[model samples]
Target: MSDDANRHDPAPNLVLGDADGGRLAENIMHFARVLRTAGLPVGPGKVLDAIDAVSQVGVASRRDFYWTLHAVFVNRRDQREVFDQAFHFFWRNPNLLERMMGMLLPAMRGEEAPEDKPELSPRVAEALAGEREPERPQEQEEEEIELDAALSVTDREVLAEKDFEKMTKDELDRARQAIKRMRLPIKPVKTRRYRADPGGRRADLRATLRASARQGGDLIWLKKRSRRRENPPLVVLCDISGSMDRYARMLLHFLHALTNDRDRVHSFLFGTRLTNITRHLRDRDPDAAIDKVTAAVEDWAGGTRIGESLHRFNADWSRRVLSQGPVVLLITDGLDREGAAGLEVEMERLHKSCRRLIWLNPLLRYDGYAPKTAGARAMIPHVDEFRPVHNLDSLAKLADTLSRSESAATGEMVRWKKLAA
Candidate 1:
């Protein structure tokens, strides 16, 4: 291959570091730290590797320097967008740098308000704001008392109600941890099989006779059995389309907790198509699990094909997963890019297959909400429950609803179904 072709090819690896060498090297180290702060997996070894790689390909040409660093740092497809934004901001791209700097300083009275600029990820924004995590010693300082709940009650309450769409970087981090600590308090469903229970109503004649035989028929011992109970299987179909972008990440954390905390839980994320992520979420580490999901899902934050996704689920997955009468959670905003084609039939089929169907919509958080869209109208009538799932309080309420002996749609929600009908 020619030298030019070889120049285009690159190596992988990057790290956070400090430079003792000189100004140029120090700047590069600082840049790598910025990327690390922005949630990239840059490490100490990668930092040394980045420095060595930069030495071979000098920073004379800006384009060459960018690509060299990109080769080392950008490992996954999803990392590209954050890497691009951080590069432009940290390297002082004249346009974005000047614009961002202007905002940091106070606006002069009567200066024309700046037009809304492009959105940056919360992680990127926080990193650029210089919010490095506080350092900790290898050993934590001994405390006489430590509270199980990290935050004060008022602060925790505030965090619980804050909308996921508007939460800051720190708030989001706390929310992710909170979701991991949560337990879905759903009650178990009874099965036809029976297990020995001392207080059971039904007599186990065979067991009683065997016990008496062991006692030489001198005494009769009564044995009892009861229906076996286990947590019902859960099938979660979550929308990851453009409209759901704000809530999807947080909800994914919720799904991950559900998968790890329960057995027979299946998670399917759908954008324009359905993708099973149950296996990925089984990873013990939340960050690693989410990374795998990000790599696997091809249609993140894309268009929605609600009817198409639901149809595929009913046709391919319903019988297999729903045979045990699992409770289904259909989480979406009901904005169908396909205009609700075949949505009603698919929704009805899904509802009938599962023991219970709960439609958890973020939009329902708003007061006086109704099924204004075609897809919502079609789907509302089929679900056994319609509930908002935007905040922690709502999630807690959902747990209570599931733990109850039985539940059905509220009267107000039923009115929506009637109107749609």
Candidate 2:
């Protein structure tokens, strides 16, 4: 008999037999199911890891088992609290699920809790039950809440509430699922090329002679084929400074999707300096691709040196990437702490090299945004377009902007150029 069998309690009808072992396994399966419902990816592999963890630590001690499973499953800071609450509630006792069901019933009935409710859990239960709900003073406030709630409400609402910067380990896993399913529409730009002319103004002498030879020296008309221009290359330079970290990460995910679906899309990341992440992002898996990019980029979340980085890019990579009139995407907040002199020169070089330069600034999400910063002033004049990139709506607008030929003519861009002169 195992050590746990000898110490098994008889008062609560506890026994350590094959049946009890099966029950434990069943509870574990239920635990994994609850975790999955809570937006954690508790797949069979993670379940197996949980089982191994339980065996290694022994399930005789409830606290030890709780922490063991936690170590195996919970990853992010935000997820830890949820997982902890779920774990406690899930494994409370034989009547735990019944208690949770009872708590949920009050929530379903929309009954308000008494003002003098005791304990934090019951208060949480009351709040969850829609008791004393905060009133929105304006229709706009309610609309915004409704919009947020409407986003993937049936799928994973908890994960959606998590900010990209504040995601926990398990929440990050759930976030990846949403990110992987995100569709990025990257349109192709056609470029000029040569082909055999089908109906040229001048006759094709070689083809005419070959056709005559085939027809025993008799004159025979021949048709000619022609080649046409193809799309311009897509070059992306994403900023990874402290201000742009979240936007950059999300954009990288979009770029990864684009790179897989499109051709000739080059991606680079810059914070303190330029790092070519085109090859790294080519990986089939987004997580693996991001891992490779993180490994390659040494200046993540560092101070912004846009001018210096652009200078380096213009000096080393411009000729290679800017050839054939590639369309350039400059994703940054234009909060260059590196001053404006070097940035002005580099921005000018970048503008001259590319067919068109589109600036994507997350700060543009604000209604009253202006190019008042030194960096924004220096770079705005050189860019062909300036666009916002913060939320889903903006990202959708970005796809439309990239597809259309309409140029960016913001008052800020025009005013900045005059001020610089």
Who wins the lDDT comparison?
A: 1
lDDT of 1: 0.79
Candidate 2 stretches greater than 4 Å from native = 1-192, 196-217, 220-227, 406-421
Instruction: For candidate 1, write residues 368-396 as lDDT tens digits.
Output: 78788899999988888888988877877
Candidate 2 on 306-383: residue-level lDDT in tens? 998898899899888888888899999988876755898889989999888889888876678778888988887788
Please provide TM-scores, in order, for all candidate models, with all chains considered together.
Answer: 0.74, 0.58
Residue 245 Cα positional deviation in candidate 1, in Å, after optimal superposition:
2.9
Give me the runs in candidate 1 sitting further than 4 Å from their true place: 1-36, 40-113, 118-124, 131-150, 217-219, 418-421
* Candidate 2 lowest-lDDT run of ten: 8-17
